[model samples]
Target: MKNLFFIPFLFLVTIASAQVQTGKASFYADKFDGHPTASGEKYRHNKLTGAHKSLPFGTKVKVTNLANNESVEVIINDRGPYVDGRIIDVSKSAAEKLGFINQGLADVKLEVVDPGDGKASDPGRPIEHVAVDENEFYEFEISRLKPKGYGIQIGTYQELVNLMRLADNLKSSYKKDVTVQVKVINGIKYYGLILGKFPSRPKAEQFREELKKKFPDAFIVEFNRL
Candidate 1:
């Protein structure tokens, strides 16, 4: 039960946990502008918004570039940096403020100044990962139960605690099953948050359209050996 502490930590994650991290940070490409973010808001290059691997969305974080000591505050609105060593992704403007737009990536330290208000997706003090207990968190195993179907992949996360927390929250709020599918990408362990089981691509696509209001990046994935 390694990370089972998350079971009780759910109610207080916003209050009890104050995480800090140090890693590489990159900014979104110009193409990402106007696309729907994980928080259901349009991605704007000028906005002070960013994406994190596992901080609650809507939380504010202070990003400091170790090179020049330049810093900027951004609101967490998405998830990512599946890139091997990156920890956070910011908007073009944020990168400019941090003085790293030309560098593409910068060594940075992150500190969470505030937690989310139940929105989309961190901070830094050097915390490596969120805690999650396997005995209690792996309950949403949709692969073996409905292995052959179309599932909507809303998000993919590194820490199981982040995946578990979102899955539990969705199941309770939407009153629908949110499946957890474990996979390994580029030597990294990740858990994907999937919603609904549709029999066909058209059906799944339709559902995805409706879900887009909440999850703009939602995409359909076929569940095979998954």
Candidate 2:
């Protein structure tokens, strides 16, 4: 998964839902079954759950198909609709309920369904966690070293060669430092390259200017710390 500044699935969704007021959402069908969800749950495309950019897990939401006004309630179980311009991603069953399974994605109005002081299920223990080292010497050493600067994810794509080539060009022509990495998202392999780390946004912008002159299509993106 693209780990940059992304929230884990489930809890904390209420905080996420509050960020955006309006947008469009879509869904997944047979193609996504058995894939890993943003919350680390294996995505069963048939489940009566969904993935939303925001909205706390277990938060029941009524999605109305704008085209036909058909509505269905579903719990926000995961994160994403990562495709640009989409608000939420529904399971195949939820999409069917919205009357858009036959047409694939649908235009819908997503409203949060408050559970009314209802406590939702925790999505289980997180799959990954950082463990603090107990070795006194190691801890002391780590404390002394100056922190390495943050790395920003400039862009990620399915093509590895494309990312590698871009990295090589950046290294050769520009004195700016860069690195390439691979991340798996719902079984899709994406390559991401970092353009350099700056302590401030203005410095990052300065570096972005030089990058734009070369890779005009490159976009500046912020890396959200996990």
**How many clashes would you count in candidate 1?**
13
What's the CA error at residue 28 for candidate 2, in Å?
1.2
lDDT of 1: 0.69
What TM-score would each prediction reach against the true structure?
Answer: 0.49, 0.43
lDDT for each candidate structure: 0.69, 0.54
Q: Model 2, range 68-155, lDDT digits (tens) per residue?
A: 8998887766667666667778888888778887777777777754321111233343423322111111000111112244444455
lDDT for 211 in candidate 2 is 57
What lDDT score goes with residue 223 in model 2?
A: 51
* Candidate 2 deviation (Cα RMSD): 18.0
Q: Best candidate per TM-score, number?
A: 1
Worst 10 residues of 2 by lDDT: 133-142
Q: Which candidate is the best by lDDT?
A: 1
